[model samples]
Target: MATTHADDPGRCPEPLSTPDDFMGGFCAFNFTSGPAAGSFCWDRQPDYSAYRESSFGHGILEVKNETYALWKWHRNQDLYQGAVGDEIYIVREPERCLLKSSIAAYF
Candidate 1:
């Protein structure tokens, strides 16, 4: 589980109170991957793509990215939403966890 906390370390986070839909100033993602059984990382930033429309029609932003966190909870519910529950990815080798090279011809 992933949650958003305040910059301070002496407070709790608030609960989900979406009356209709969406939150403000908060975004989170739990990464569960590795060579082992329960290795994981809480990534505050996720890989995202940006797009825009100009006189040349639709196009992707090669420099600007709009992916970001967009939710904020009250600083008083850390126990319920702050703790990371369940199992995560188990990593044996740190280098192999993230692919850095492309696959070539294999025999």
Candidate 2:
């Protein structure tokens, strides 16, 4: 689950045992706003080689080479929204993604 940085300063999972190895788990993040506002968790059931975010309304995930896209469902408006190259970070070891004040232009 996602939480404030002051609540849980999570650590990245341990490295895979081998290059071809697979590890399964999850990581909580403290993102600023939006669907991932609080108590957010990312699935790492296969591997941490990629980043992903999903919710009832939308999903943003990495496809390859650190590229990501957003898919949203505007059910009431009967429209689907999508975009590529959304901002995200894949934190590992000695690094962290922290929350800050939201910027109006980002909307």
Off by more than 4 A, model 1: 1-5, 17-20, 23-107
**Model 2 misplacement above 4 A:** 1-24, 32-38, 41-60, 66-107
**Cα-based lDDT at residue 45, candidate 1:** 27
lDDT per residue for candidate 2 within 1-107, as digits (tens), equals 34232222353332332232232343335556543355343322334333423332333544444333333332222234443323555434222223433432332
User: Model 2 — which ten-residue stretch has the worst lDDT?
Assistant: 14-23
- For 23-84, candidate 1 gives per-residue lDDT tens digits of 35433333345321231232222335233112212212232224332232222334554433
Decoy 1 TM-score against native: 0.15
